[model samples]
Target: MLAGKRILLIIGGGIAAYKSLDLIRRLRERGAAVTPVLTRAGAEFVTPLSVSALAGEKVFTDLFDLTDEAEMGHIQLSRSADLVVVAPATADLMAKMAHGHANDLASTLLMATDTQVLIAPAMNVRMWEHPATRRNLAQLLADGIRVVGPNAGDMACGEYGPGRLSEPLEIVAAIETALGQGSLTGKRILVTSGPTHEPIDPVRYIANRSSGAQGTAIAHALAALGAHVIFVTGPADVPPPQGVQVVRIETAQQMLQAVEAALPADAAVFAAAVADWRVASSSGSKIKKDAGRLPVLEFAENPDILATVSQRKADRPGLVVGFAAETDDVIANATAKRARKGCDWIVANDVSPATGIMGGTENAVHLITAHGREDWPRMSKQDVAARLATRIAQALG
Candidate 1:
């Protein structure tokens, strides 16, 4: 999707600066031409030679080099790219950008550029949450700059919170979203993600190995393409993407109700691993542990959310996509599921312990449509989601 696009990557100083190298390679792999500019502090972490080598272009550093300025003026340099990306945007750099300071080449380009700018911030938890930093962030947002992540996780300082830079593939996905042709701009999409927890008692419950990473990524990708997304999510470790309406649920029945409420959308993606069954009669309180006897529990089938939505006679979505997570005969089972559920498409992935696709960062899926199964290569969940979102957009059109 980024073929022939010009990307101006501004490297900021931080421990996560290394990830920018991978980001450059990934963008180049997708046929984007990269121009790298390094801040003075950024040079402390990564060498100009390394940046130049990875980008296959000269690294711009000095703001007052007469020869370089004669060749390409700073104003032209700033305006040449389709997009400006600042990775590891430190607190200092952010403040400078927010206040329009042009003390350095990086800040000057950021101030002078007219193109859309995307920033990925990396800092300590305290620094990220500081009132000054928060104000700067708000200013950037008000100025229409797109911010990707300062994901909550362990930082280089050995502390954990919202200060980690997003992974390389995630940054790539955001860039693609910013540059996509808006194929799904006018569509309305519904997606369900995560694993439903069936309560056995107030304290204990039944759940699965679904992290909802893939499904949540799908919703974000759809929204990035300008689609109005109604995201019905079960309990997940990760936070939901911004700019999309989210509905929270904890059980199969709740998910079904949420999906029903979001009907008449252009497409539906049943990616949540809804429980197969629930406790027939859940205890109001925690069950007491007996000295020698095991408690007897009864199971009852949960509602078939995907099948119900796909087979709806009134106010049905134009297209329905279901996910089949299987241990054996993945494609065959998914094919049967597509036929039985009457969904327009089925995405099948093997979740056996041996495969490790479940709750993992990557996936290999088969897209089962009326024509045949199209096997995709093993890739990051974000890539898988973006590709699937694009396909849904095309199908909707």
Candidate 2:
């Protein structure tokens, strides 16, 4: 999709800088040429030789290299590529870019470049959430720079939250979205993913076994088709996709609120495995386990987000797709679910332990719709996403 594209990749200083090597391979696989510029601190983690080897081009490092300057001026270097991408765009690098500082070759090229810029930020959780970093991010976005990921998870510092760099494929998807011809352009879609956590106390909760790989793939596929996506996700094993607005939530109720806030979408896909019940009167503190006494737990039904959105009286989406994770009578169960929930379509899959579909990489799904059911062959989750996204585009049209 990115054939003939020339990408100038700027590797910033962060532990996530190592992923930049893999990003080069992904970009080159899609027929884009990568020209890498490594920062001083970035060189600390990865050697220039490795970057050059993977990118298949000489790595540029210094602003005052007389020989390199004679070969290609900074102005020429900055504007030479079709796109400028900064992977592991550290806080310092972003601050410099936001303020147009050019102390180093990376910042200098970023400032002097006339081409479009995309950054994938990586820092500690605290740094990423800091006011200074927030200001820099806002400024960068306001200046028309595209961003990919700083996914929330366990960090290298034993801290957890949003600050990790996106995976290689996610970054590549972002690059494709930035450069590819729009297929679902101007369309807005809402997608929910992962397993919601229903808190029972300060230290415990209820969740599911959803790996979130399928939903993440779907979001990426839709984004690749040029649709503006609102991704409302819960605590998932896999990180969310790139190039979409991600709203993280913990409970089903919060997911409903976030989904409602992203209103009037063209379609809504409920891929998340939300808990059906929550603690009615969860203890404020952890419930102590007694040797002989048993504790009573009361449960209440959680919000049915798919049903609520599908049965909306006003401003309902043109297409509302829901998933049925059934172990037996998949088609019958999903068909019944479609009619009962008032959704336009239902994606049914057998998640039995024998099939290993719950947390596996592949899926065998039956798409149930008003017209009838279509049984798709077993395929990778990514393939399933692509086919479903294409069908959605056709349906919306």
Residue range 39-94, candidate 1, lDDT tens digits: 88888999999999999999999999898788657888899999999998999999
What number of clashing residue pairs does each candidate have, in the order they appear?
0, 0
- Model 2, range 1-397, lDDT digits (tens) per residue? 5789999999998889999999999899879999999999999999999999998999999999998789667888899898999999999999999898989899999989999899999999999999999999999999999898778789889999999998777677577666643668999999999999998999999888999889998999898889999999999999999899999999999999999999999998999999999999889999999999998889999999999999997879999999999989898999999999999999999999999889888899999999999998786687678668877877887
lDDT of 1: 0.91
For model 1, what is the error of residue 200's alpha carbon versus the real structure, in angstroms, after optimal superposition? Answer: 7.8
Those runs of model 1 whose alpha carbons end farther than 4 Å from true positions after fitting are 67-72, 124-131, 151-164, 181-183, 194-217, 233-262, 278-303, 308-318, 327-391, 394-397
TM-score of each: 0.75, 0.57
What is candidate 2's TM-score against the reference? 0.57
